[model samples]
Target: MFGYVIKRHQLWSGKVLLFPLSSSCASGASGVRFVFGRASAAGTERRTAPAESTGQGEAMYRRKMRGMYISKRALRKHFDPHNYPRETYLLCELQWRGSHKFWQHWLRNDDSKDCHAEKYFLEEIFEPRSYNICDMTWYLSWSPCGECCDIIQDFLEEQPNVNINIRVARLYYTDRASNRKGLRELASSPGVTLEIMDAEDYNYCWETFIQPGVYYRFSPENFESAIKRNCSQLDDILQGLHL
Candidate 1:
């Protein structure tokens, strides 16, 4: 969201990196560790290229970023196991061809058919490149749906040079088998790294996107615990059949 990328670096280093899928943890790569100055975020934003303000880039930095910002209260509502909006929003940062591009999108209605946010990024915003390395970090309001999982899978399969690191604000219908299967499959994907957003991520998104240069805000009383609970649920999705 606010700060970084290291697609499945945890897969490389024995360290947990951001989220823990298991109890076993150890350190490995130094460069990967160095980039993540704090928590799951990169120390500095990799904006080698400026983000577009016009056209399809959705460069409404504060304008749309604020409009798209998810509040802690909203996180509690949608992050709950029993309730959630039937929508998705993605805060994505991509480092490609020595440039960093940022974009955000939500599901769009095109002639009655739902167009997912992921589609905009995968199909519209960025072109496929097989030469240089591409690292993507996504802060999703909701985890990718089963259908989206398949879509993301196909997309990643094609872009062998692309690597994705995802952190979701909430788990999406993990009670449903199809969603869980898709999520687990994604976790197992070669170049994919998935984790539930924790307090650090919450702060990172806020500072980087919503209110840069502002003082850090305090979280709700239950917010930290809620994150732990959701993280446990995510670990379960990747580690077990139950959510």
Candidate 2:
């Protein structure tokens, strides 16, 4: 869930950014290093004399830059494992929205079907046979827990990977409001640190913690952006992350 578009500089320097994938370690030092594989042809320089250069042999220096230097947000599409095996994940809020019938139809479809995208994504992104997927309706506070927590806890208990991710489906307008309640619950939990974002005070957040490199899945216009904008100071724990 913490996946992000890393800053352009780190992308250029070929440094693997680290992020806290597990709740237990989320509050501690950089959780783990998810290294970005380096670009080829590092430091290979070439120089050409200026066309206007006098008898003096003045050369302009240039280095061959290997690897596509796309923007941070675009990295996921450019380097997706399905598309590019040696790929890393980017930030996204995956919501599960359809009914059982929808999933039933999905389960019956082949890879070529449009509905198959969700199933394929789950298979590739989620730990195999580890978590139970479910859908729950939204409410004022902790509404998802009574019905959904079991499936979630079951998945967490089964998956041993420290680098775990939570995915949701079927995002709606009300979903944003639900997010606030859910995040509050998570933050109030024993070890969770809730980073609430208020839309009106967004600029304060951006200047506070979000480091230069990290970018959230929420668009610039989304309420979450305001929160990130104000909490930019949290960048102290975010820059140059690997996991």
Candidate 3:
């Protein structure tokens, strides 16, 4: 996950300064577009301002600024959809020895890219660590499937130093007996913690990591209700299987 903060310039011209908060993006950059209005005012219009320099300096600066703006906007637009309805993507945040790392991976149902998020985490992040203890928290748009459960179960059995905490948008279960058994197995894991994500968790991730500028207005009570509803349905399915 990536985010940027905006800095406003104190100008008497009533124009608000907006710049990409990233260091790499801000390097060698000049003036950006300014909005002429009060901070509390609505529908403020933005107007382009001339670069502070000309010739090679202006051209190179604009090129870098444009690339950063386009890339940041494109990433937000492309990944925002994956966090809902589709539930095909997963993001992991790892905290170890006062350092934090993030990894985002997606799973496709039929394609060769059917790699699981856990496998990616193990191969990319966990393998490189020299420390023995690490805490891994997963922000999954959908719960793990049966195959994923088996893979993670084997992993935890081998690596006792890792602790996993999973917060998911929704559960994915079926009427199949194997699926139900898998869910039970995953829930019974000793070193792993799993739960439906609450609004606080959602808001924290949204503000601190995903999109710093946008506020997530979802309520914790509503999220709890959704979890209850999903649990009720899962209970009915499990009762039908008599397991």
Candidate 4:
């Protein structure tokens, strides 16, 4: 229990409530998510939150959202092979394939009680607003674990229209056989494309998601070897799984 308050009414079955990741999101505006927990132990399905509107209070809301990126220094600390962050973060964009409420939002498991950011996306966001043709892109601070892979696979199976391009900053638990196997299976999915985040991707994420002019980019000397290392492992994971 993270001791967070549940502001939204639970409209769907699941464990945790996912509204107001910040107090600003309580207004329920577009792009603001209102997520409930995953399906219950007895088989209740979970639901995701929609982003508070990007309309009226757009500027202020952006500040609130952008603040979550923490700082440039924080981003750099975890890229090292000897020191990776325990938490996972997801920044996603749903394009014009009918994933409206999810439009562009970020989620992180570090702050949540019992779920990763991906669980919120799968259960609450994508599950409720599935479309005939879904095209989305994601930037994940860490690749998913084995369980989330199964869940993602199921989601794609049911919603054959949902397609994802996941660019992860680092591979999660590559030392574990199960995690690698799970990623390999996930890479085999027809609708998912998994790749390591390169410097360009990091630059894009910083430019797009972080608050503007607040943090300076690190020197090119940073994270270069880490990126190469992660990329090599990702290629190995997906070597023969690509369709």
Output the number of the TM-score-best candidate: 4
Clashes of each: 0, 30, 0, 24
**lDDT for each residue of candidate 3 in 12-115, tens digit (9 for 90 to 100):** 23343334333422222111222122211111112122222111110011222222122223223323322344323444554332322222222212123445
Instruction: Supply the TM-score for candidate 2.
Output: 0.23
Q: Please provide, for model 2 over 1-243, each residue's C-alpha lDDT reduced to its tens digit, 9 standing for 90 to 100.
A: 122221212111344333322322111111111222221111111212222212211111111121222233333232221232222222221112111111101111122232222222233223232222322111111112222333333433443221222221111122344433433333233311223223422332232213446665533244344335324522321231211
Name the best candidate (by lDDT). Answer: 4
lDDT per prediction?
0.54, 0.24, 0.45, 0.57
Candidate 4 TM-score, true structure as reference? 0.66
Clashing pairs in 3: none
Candidate 1 vs. true structure, TM-score: 0.61
TM-score of each: 0.61, 0.23, 0.54, 0.66
Ranking by TM-score: 4, 1, 3, 2
Model 2: weakest 10-residue lDDT segment is 99-108
Q: Of the candidates numbered 1 and 2, which has the greater TM-score value?
A: 1
Q: How many backbone clashes does candidate 3 have?
A: 0
In candidate 3 the C-alpha lDDT for residue 99 amounts to 26
